[model samples]
Target chain A: MHNIKIVLIQTFHPGNIGAAARAMKNMGLSNLVLVNPVDFPSDEATSRAGQATDVLENATVVSSLEEAVQDCQLVIGTSARDRTITLPALTSQQCGEKLVAEQQSGKVAVIFGRERMGLHNSDLKQCHFQLNIDANPEYPVLNISQAIQIVCYEVFKAGQKQYEPQIEAYPLNDDLNRFYDHLESSLTGSGFIKPSHPGQAIEHLRALFKRARPTSKELQILRGMLSSFDKE
Target chain B: MHNIKIVLIQTFHPGNIGAAARAMKNMGLSNLVLVNPVDFPSDEATSRAGQATDVLENATVVSSLEEAVQDCQLVIGTSARDRTITLPALTSQQCGEKLVAEQQSGKVAVIFGRERMGLHNSDLKQCHFQLNIDANPEYPVLNISQAIQIVCYEVFKAGQKQYEPQIEAYPLNDDLNRFYDHLESSLTGSGFIKPSHPGQAIEHLRALFKRARPTSKELQILRGMLSSFDKE
Candidate 1:
């Protein structure tokens, strides 16, 4: 999440740059470096950025991809097309995981190529590995912004997974069973489940509750509801 | 793949429609059904579609979710928010796998809701399950097109899994059904489940087996064990 820069090499559209910034911001990523963008500080870029002008305002503009990514310890070049060279190609997910793992060591850069031509083989040579997004084989090209959104999403997900909060334990089987018993009697009293045909109704109710795997608190609430229903 | 349909309900932006079409095409999916799109055939949509005009051109326009998915056997709704009623929630990956497995049985529809307001409670009721995309918790509000890209990518990946060598096949629904039937009858015959009150016992066993998701070979072994129990 920190010390990670997104480098756009030879970007042709100001709108894409803005959209890329917006995408990065959506994933809680802020650092952006533009290499030889056709236009900077344009109205179109700002308008597309919507409320994410801070990212656009803070973006660093550089002359070349090398200059933009020089500080990065890990450089990943994104390519839509397959190349003749046998460089290790990683999916967007794999790239994100690798970036998160290596981010603590130093700065990491995910470099996106130009709109039409993408990154040249020479530019790709600077990368340790190529990141290839698995897209529809029929029309595999993704908008630059769309690609950024996906890659940033992966990185964000990886970081989030590392800090995922532990969930409370599910209710024990005995608690669930007791809740079910209370529910059955309440429903039968309410005429929702006829005494003679309660077996099928109770089974379906059990199935529904089992699928939910409610927490201990939720089970208590459900039992309370049944008691209220019984009183009614 | 042939019978899968992407249903967009009340899409607000024409540009998002175009982007979604591009995303679908990028993943080798073309069946697009729009339910009450704000604007179609707009210049912005076409422009965003880039080379994916075929998907946009051949897209079907429907009035309601019922109409769009009436013929489909499996309907999956995508929801960013958790609901009060617990539906069987599947991750994008799991949704893809289930869709692929059931595609041969009938048409499968993956429905996306509007930009600002997602599908209503009634709309969700029509779905067999819900697909929740893992996104940045800070900004989980993904652009509609970005969600489409992630989902289509998952489906494409699941399709690719069939050709991926050495992975044992998961038991198909039909195979699981046969195994469940055998299990129930054997349990009844073995006195584990009393014949008169077998409903709840069979339902619990079914739930347990479904959660286990035994592979094809494992199903066969279970059926063999049931046969042995029947003999005893």
Candidate 2:
């Protein structure tokens, strides 16, 4: 993740730079390259960064986006999907996965443009792919840090593709059946269910519980409460 | 879509509320609810909200999480996995799919807790599930608004999937709350709840019912059944 650079071009809001740094750090990416930011080393950026001031402190400031990503094997620029500039585009998910997969081989970058106007044509040309974040066409423009956030989140997920399998323990059929039986008997005792006329109420409850797929501990709690009700 | 609510609880930063509004709007989510914010109607929030100031303007301010999501059927809280509270959990992807699929039936919510402390145990109990955005374990915390960005992105993607709702519309939070109230009263009448010594029993039941997420018709049956118990 460190090999991938988050390059921002002439960012007008220092807070965005700070937010972007925080976004990158939260996702485990540390390389930050700023291309002629309007303001750098500002208190606003530092204040917005929360705990990620280290990323900003270590940032590499360059004169141009070209110079920032010059040594990178791949560069992905973010833009609205319907922009006039035409280029091979990667969705934010694709950008994240690709960067994580390919970052080890060489330096890589995912660049973001200025706040109001996105990347210029020249900036887009320097990229191997334009990254399109999924959004409503009516208002596709995303705040710069928010755009970085989506991209960074994707990268984080892709990098952890082999995350440890879930360790949650679900109830066995016997316990679940016991729970259902206890539930039915208790409800019958409480007059919530009648003995002779079983209807769809239990079925609906069953279906809803089935979808939830309770863990073993949760099932125990359910059974324990029902047993207490029976004692009453 | 319009039925989805983005609820923020007691946010200390007004800028975050604004950024959250922008994040929600960027992904076509409009509903924003604030539960006892430290500051609102501030220039900082509006300035940060960008063109999404309308979302902030139309935001609902409530005193409690219970009030904020009273009308929502399914409520999801955003939190790290290592919290003291436990609930049925969903990844950001699943949270998106579930909310989109079930939203047509009743209002749904995705909640964010305070910036420093995250959601409280009381808050977690109100939720059927918790949303954990994948991130570096060493530093999994994301800016409140940035987390909103990722969740909304997944939601936007899921919406684009053009999913057909297979499940029946669920009951509104108001009806669900009423059913709970009736259940609690009936249980108390049955000596199921000791007034001086209420423990995890009711909360666990609330969590269970929330997980089941009964439909309006199903809730009616449950409530009707509870009424019978009261009569008995």
Candidate 3:
């Protein structure tokens, strides 16, 4: 559970951070990372954290979402709106099992975006799977801390059950991002993608590759093929 | 489920009432009976309810705990402490599944005790099952609304109307096979795949892409990438 980092991106409230810490600790999770929080070391957050203040004390703070999940093999972004057709989605239960299983191999991240606005398209692009919590459509919005509680609860439940550790050595997030960058450049140089057109063609390509979730060796092969195209 | 009710007993916080209403609405539960809430129709509660203000507006305010569950056939009490041994205890997951199934026959209720003091022995006698949310023993007590959120989330999941965020249209086998042919020739044209080594390299690449099951649009992107390589 320690390898499963709960990454919060640009959180608006200090209280939510405290509540999130409490939730994570209650679920037997210890890792907590904050990306550009509005306020930290606040009284309000500490007060809400209860006896789980230890989780808040040891939290890692970073400047960007990319920095928070750089070493992770799987980055799961939670989204309220269903926008990214490119990324595969996981239910909360599936997300819990996936996180627990993947954590055995390497660090895995479940990212929570800003309270007011959800994940930016760029941040969404970084995620391997989009975690969607099932709720009533009429009022699907759950408070940020509450959302964290539900996810952590599911994680705790999953942790209690036995799981076979994931055997696949997946490419890390940094490497995956670099590969996407190389892909875009190579496609542009080959005239398969136009600068003016920008995204649809590239987005489709990115989605295809992401949905596939290439293994490290497969990623290497794809990269080598792209490099050869670059030479031409 | 309309037949399912969330009965909060002697709630002290005005904010939690609103939070409970939002949690109930989010989980598709509409019946909320507050047993002698310290504050009713408070601004804090209304604000916390978000789009679920309707649930709060329609909440049943009662004088006593007995009155709240008088009409309900089944009552399940939630407790922070595991004290009741006489009755069957259900994990939160089981509680949700049980509630959903039992609601079909008649009315069912899940009870939450006060913030500071949990359910009394007298209250425990009224409930058929005691609901327990499994958490780290060090910080087992959750925020009132957070507990409600977990229970409601499980109930919503038990309802079995999960959402599919992305409905991908995968490529047909014939189209996928044709794209594999194009990919092999393109890699060979670019000299990334040596023709003399034959099918081994192509075979591995095919297995990777086939496992990915790229959508029809992605297959088109692949084909276009191959076309660009042919030009190179």
Error of 1 at B21 (Å): 0.6
Kindly report which residue stretches of model 1 are placed more than 4 angstroms away from their true locations once superposed. Answer: A162-209, A212-232, B82-88, B163-232
The models' CA-based lDDT, in order, is: 0.77, 0.85, 0.87
- Write the residue-wise lDDT of candidate 2 on B1-232 in tens digits: 8899999999999999999998899899999999999999899999988889999999999999999888877899989756643676799999999889878777899999999999988788678788988887778899999999999999999898877756666666667777888878867776767788976677767766777777777777777766666665
Q: Which stretches of model 3 miss by more than 4 angstroms?
A: B161-167
- Model 1: per-residue Cα lDDT over B135-162, one tens digit each: 6555566678878887887788788776
Worst 10 residues of 3 chain A by lDDT: A80-89
Classify candidate 1 by CAPRI docking class. Answer: incorrect
Clashes of each: 2, 0, 0
> Candidate 3 lDDT, tens digit per residue, B107-168?
99999999889788889888999988999877788888899999999898888855448666
Residue A163, model 2: Cα distance from true site in angstroms: 4.2
Candidate 1 residue-pair clash tally: 2
Candidate 2: regions farther than 4 A off: A81-85, A163-169, A187-193, B224-232
Q: What is the DockQ of each candidate?
A: 0.18, 0.60, 0.75
Question: What's the distance in Å from true for residue A106, model 1?
Answer: 0.4
Task: State chain A's TM-score for model 3.
Answer: 0.97
